[model samples]
Every structure is written in structure tokens, then in C-alpha cells.
Target: MTRIIAAVATAALLLTSTSAFAQAAFPTRPNTLQGQAACAGYTVDNYKERFAANSGGPDVQLHSLCAGAYNYYWMYLNAIRKGFSESDCNVTYDAFDKAARVVTNFWAETH
Candidate 1:
């Protein structure tokens, strides 16, 4: 019984630690979140809203990756004005911004 409790406790600790670390790895920017909400909205929520909104899987994953990438632009520009370059922020935004556009265009064309 003691061993089982210890194992469960260890698992819980590991889960909590990993979860915190995962969230920590994710970028943080209220502005970014706001921007994503805006861009994602198809005037109210995103392209998926009109046809199908996949909250997960490849397309949805792509959407998330792109959203995060797009937000980097605002985050970096703000950080820069505050005196930090935030080079990492720059790449994701620029690349993803264009990709989002292309993806949208592609969808518009195909559908």
C-alpha cells in the first residue's frame, strides 16, 4: 500500500511538473491571444467556423501553429519598443503570417 501511494504521488508530481513546464514553454502575450482571436474569427471565429472547425488534428494543429506564429509579430514589435530585439519572436510571426495568408487563399481557391 505504501509503495502504491508513493508511485501515485511520484506520477502526480511528474505530471504536474511536466504540465507546468509545457505551459512555460508556450509563449505568453495577451496581445498575441487577442490577435489570434481576431485573426481566427471569420468576422466572429475563423475559417473553420464557416465550414468545419477542427479543434485538433493536422489542420487544427496547423491553425494553432499559425496563430502562435502570427502573434509573435505583435509581441516582438512591442518588446522591441521596450528595448529588446526578441529575435525568436520575429521569425515565427513573419513566416506564419505569410503562411496563414497562403492557407486562407488556398482554401478560398479550392473551396
Candidate 2:
């Protein structure tokens, strides 16, 4: 009975530790600007592609352009948040550039 209790306690502790580690790994919010910008840029790229394929009208295009601009601005904001130096921001810019390239590549392949 004692051995059984010890094993159960050990399993419980292991489970609790694993849960804590998982929570720590998850972000509470957008803490890094560059990461957030990369996510937003990817989202904008998807929107642009959809708009290109099935544009509603000028209004839709205008909205898509504005959204892309917003994500581009967010990239700079994220770079600042991440304490990126002017030169280091090239990394952040590269993320945005890569997102655009990915979308363009998909478009080229599809249409």
C-alpha cells in the first residue's frame, strides 16, 4: 500500500510539472513584436490573395490594402517592442518579405 501511494504521488507530481511547463511555453499575449508581425503579415498575405481571386470591388481592394498597411506598420512596432536595433530590424523586415514571397509563390503556382 505504501509503494502504491508513493507511485501515485510521483505520477501526480510529474503531471503537475508537465502542466506548468506547458502553460509557461504558451504566450499570454503578443509579447514579441517581430513574432506578432510575422503572424499578422501572414494573415494579410492570405487576405490579399483571396481579394485578388474574388475581389468584391474597389471597396474590397481598398480594405485589403489598408489591412496590409496596418500589418506592415505592426511589423515595425513589433521590432521596437523586441528591442531590435535599426540593423536588427532587417530580420523583422525579412519576415514580412518572406510572407509576401510565399503568397506570390502560391499565386504563381495556382494561377
* CA lDDT of each prediction against the hidden true structure: 0.41, 0.40
Candidate 1 wrong stretches, greater than 4 Å: 1-38, 42-54, 57-62, 84-93
Per-residue lDDT for 1-111 in model 2, tens only?
A: 344334334433443443221112212223232333222333423545644554567445333533443354355344445444444444334444444444344445544
For candidate 2, the lDDT comes to: 0.40
Give me the runs in candidate 2 sitting further than 4 Å from their true place: 1-73, 77-84
Local error of candidate 2 at 33, Å? 20
| Highest lDDT scorer | 1
lDDT of 1 by residue, 26-69 (tens): 34332333343324553213433422455555556446544433
C-alpha RMSD of candidate 2: 16.5
Which ten contiguous residues of candidate 1 have the minimum total lDDT?
Answer: 17-26
CA shift at 40, candidate 1, in angstroms? 3.5
